[model samples]
Target: MTRDKNKKKPPAVQQEKLNPRELNTEENKHSNHPLLDTASAEIKKYLHDLIEEFKDVLLIQVRQDIKKLIKEMTSPAQENTDGRTEEIRKEREASEEEFKHNLEYMKQIQREYQETQNSIEYWQNALTETKDNLLKLEERFRAYERERKSLLKITRNQKEAILKLEDDKKIHNLRIKNVSEEAGTSKNEIQKIFTEILKQNFPRIAKRNDIQIKEAYRTPATYNQNRSTPRHIIIEIPEIHQKNRILKAARERMQVTYNGKSIKITADLSTQTLKSRREWGEIFQVLKEKNMQPKFIYPSKLSLKINEEIRYFQDKEELWEFVATNPTLQRALKDITEKERKRYQDYSYSGREASVNGADHGMRE
Candidate 1:
């Protein structure tokens, strides 16, 4: 291979002008292009350097473009991250404000609950006190009721005893009505007049001593010259039988004269006994009309003859009970029974009201 070192190459052929990239081909090397085979060493070295410099310049340009593209892509992501951070800060502030508001509302609710509890406790205590007071009042009312009933029983018994005493005092007394009252008339003169009148009517030869007059006087009243009515003469006898005899004799005679005037003689009775007797008037008249032979048995009792037997009634209530057993009597006395029932109810109601008022007065005392 060294033997042809100085040998002459083929003649250079005239070709189209080409760049180094076109000249550096496998076809040119295989074809033994005259410029490639016989080119000067300096020329080859210059072409190699030019190609290496071009590659270097291209690599630098590529690196600059890639860096610019990456910067462009990452700038928008960074801006988005900053915007998201600002939104997170605003959301945190809003959540904190809502929490504060809820806390304030919860505190207010707690305060209201405490106030309600206090009110409930106060009402409970008041209710307890009210219940205690009511119980006390009930007990006091019951005690007053018992005391009132006991007082009513005692009062009724005392009144009955007083009435009995009054009636007993008048047992031997008589009243003569329509007797002329003369001024300056003495008790002895009145007694003598009564004796004369009794003797003239009875014809028993009763002397002044036989009459047994204990005392005699006109009813106490102021004497007036212009007064037309005369006061009655009240006489007290020593014995009850003597008084009864005079009453019987007076009843037997239709008219008794004293100083040419007819007078009425009746038994002197207590005011209470007289009132009770008057209350029996209507019943007495009805019984007499029916031929029941009813007679007053002193102090408001009645003796009735029925079925040939004698029956006694102590009060209208007892008579009502007996009449209820007899349909005919009940029918006949229906209106009277109703009237009496209404009267009794009114009396009972008034009595209760009086008792209550008296009890209240006693309590105050």
Candidate 2:
């Protein structure tokens, strides 16, 4: 029993023993652990604060730099602004100058147009006036032509009348010449016969006046035998009373003298007596009794003749008057007059010699 009790007691008192080196190693590890942990946490907290402060500082510096750059870029420059303003002013001035030039040019063109218009109007008015004058001149020319035609007609009539008058004068002269030739009478003898015829036909003149009769005798015996007779007869009668008597005697004589001759006689009424029908009829009957036929030439024919003569004479007178007024014509006329005088003197001398020779021959015979 004792032994088992002792063993149990011993076993209750026994313990485990550690190594020194291992104990030291484990103590060191434990001792360094608190230091490492504290160091890591301190380092972490320090890094967080440093990062926050650096972020704040960086943001503030960036904002300041951006503001400075903007100020530099956006600021106005005085010199450049002034230059731009001056350039704008110059452009405005140039525009105004161009407008003024254009206005002046337009005004010049308008003035030229107005002047041209005025010239055209003046020319038109002148042309119108000239046309009017020309028309008036044409009218005047037409009037002149009408007047000329009238004058020409008058001239033609006058010429025909003048020719008829000349023919009548020629016929009368021819009749006188023929009668003188046929009678074989001297001018004085014929005149005496005419006077006797007037006295015989004019009873009123024969009764009113005393006529002395004379005759030509070949011998003194014949003269003594016809002592009461005169060689010529003179009847003292007025010309007015003798005219009608002379015409009657001439008609009676013509009937006796031209018994077998183809003789035609005509009596015309005087224009003054034409209105007196009784006087005209009496004259007509007287002419018919003397075997004379009366013919009436148109009054207009006679008037035309007179007018023609007048016109012809007027033209001749105009020419003669002009010539007479000229000194050259006057000298020419004087020369002609002198020449005519010389010719007349020569003819008179020749005629006197011929007359003297004829008288000598008559005395010898």
| Per-residue lDDT of candidate 1, residues 150-249 (tens digit) | 7766776676578778978877889888877763257888888787777767677375457678888887655677878888788999888888888887
Instruction: Return the TM-score for each candidate structure.
Output: 0.50, 0.29
TM-score of 1: 0.50
**What is the clash count for each candidate, in the order shown?**
0, 7
After superposing candidate 2, which stretches have Cα over 4 Å from the reference? Answer: 1-88, 171-365
Cα lDDT of candidate 1 equals: 0.75
Q: Model 1, stretches more than 4 Å misplaced? A: 1-157, 205-209, 224-228, 307-309, 314-318, 321-328, 331-341, 348-365
Quantify how close model 1 is to the true structure by its C-alpha RMSD in Å.
11.8
In TM-score terms, which candidate is top?
1
Residue 14 in candidate 1 has what lDDT? 59
- How many residue-pair clashes does candidate 2 contain? 7
Score residue 139 of candidate 1 by CA lDDT.
84
